[model samples]
Target: MSYIKAGTDVNGNDVKLHYIDQGQGSPIVLIHGWPATYEMWEYQLAELPKHGHRVIAYTRRGFGNSSKTWEGNDYDTLADDLNAVLETLDLQDVTLVGFSMGGGEVARYMSRYNGARVSKVAFVSAVTPFLLKTDDNPDGADKSVFDDMVDGIRKDRFDFLQSFGKKFFGVGVISHPVSQATLDWMQSICQLASPRATEQCVYAFAATDFRQDLATLKVPTLVIHGSSDDTVPAKVSGERMTQYVSHAQFVEYSGAPHGLFVTEKERLNRDILAFAAGGTVEGTADRY
Candidate 1:
């Protein structure tokens, strides 16, 4: 087990990012989502190396070790933070692995800037194109839902994360009957994030529209989603996301939920490695 190394974002804030660097060959950067940290990728860190890939997972600003700033909670700032991390480490030819909200950041950054540094991309249970249901996005969660969520965050960020965490899992119960350990770990990691920062990020995600961003993804892309996901339903966000990305492949896991990257880590890692290895991937794997 490796310890997280400390670092800072482009803004030069005292941001701490936990990372597990393993193996050597191609570099793969794993970006996690809200209410979760780099620790969410523990299973992938341990397994991806055997496939001849260097896997890196880090907590985003306002989550886990990274510094929590009241400012820069929007997607553009988040993308700049990622750029700073990659550039600071002098990493190149990277395969960006983004899960949930992390997917939004990746797509936004790739849309704005594309170079040899980013080779390919992957989205696991992501929120893209757009999350909030506007007049145009009628199928998405209503704006009121996001408003209520933000309201809950303002009322009490901790409890808000706890309740939000429940929605992240398929079985919408607070007790977490399916995977209590994962749930507990998620809560603990979230506790490390700045409550104010998390709350601000909620606004950023709920408002930002990534449809144009997805249209700009020109590199090889992999879109993975859980068929049964309630948070970001496959039929709604993930499916539509694939349609927008020019060179994207879609993979749907039936019966899987939003937390497949956790519950189904092994299978997720397998598919990611195979795709990163330049092989064709089409079909579902085991559900964790």
Candidate 2:
């Protein structure tokens, strides 16, 4: 990683985009989810470069070291902000990857904007197709659950985020190999995020229906899910997304939780590289 060059968006409001540019092949733009910064993909930057692919991961507004925005925080605005970042950098022949809420960002882009610069798409533990249960989506979580989440945010966002962090790992109260230091680091990152923006994002995640948007995607897409993900279950969210995405490949990680990116980074990274490098590989859950 080198000193990040600053860039401005269409709003002329300095949108702090930090990047680690390496390798000399097609670019891979990584979009992270709620309460996480570009640092989440730190595991990828060093490796992907050695593999001959450019990896660009940046902090979205109101997260990490990026400029905090209290203005509008919605999916459309978030998508436009990303578009600005991509356009300003003049990135082409790119592979867009998104995880969790980041997946919502990817789906929104594919649906609204013409993917002129993007060649491939990957969704790792993405929330898409639909997250809220309605007349059409009986499988989704009840609307009240989202409403309760919003209420929790309203009461005490900091504690809410802290508690949410535990559920994010889905390991429950039991212990894991990942040290307390690592867990604290992740929690600190989530805690640093602006509560106002993060709360709005919760609504964005719960309310927005990406089914229609996903149906419009023609680009080669990979949908990766963990079987034991409690935050956003594989069957309801990811599995449903595949039905909408034309020609999308599905991969399931057995007993892998939502934090598969962190818990199973090596295998996830390998899968991503193989798919992007024009190599044939299986998409099912197999221990690396």
TM-score versus the correct structure, for each prediction: 0.89, 0.90
Which residue runs does candidate 1 get wrong by more than 4 Å? 1-16, 172-177, 284-288
Over the stretch 178-265, how does candidate 1's per-residue lDDT look in tens digits? 5667767778888887877777877787789989888777788888998888777887777887558756788888778888887677
Pairs that collide in candidate 2 are none
**Candidate 2: misplaced stretches above 4 Å?**
1-12, 175-177, 285-288
State residue 137's C-alpha deviation in candidate 2, in Å. 1.5
CA lDDT of every candidate: 0.78, 0.78
For model 2 the TM-score comes to 0.90
For 164-237, candidate 2 gives per-residue lDDT tens digits of 76777765657463556667878788777787777778888888998888888888788899988888899898
lDDT of 2 at 235: 86
| 189 Cα displacement, candidate 2 (Å) | 1.1
Question: Could you tell me the TM-score of candidate 1?
Answer: 0.89
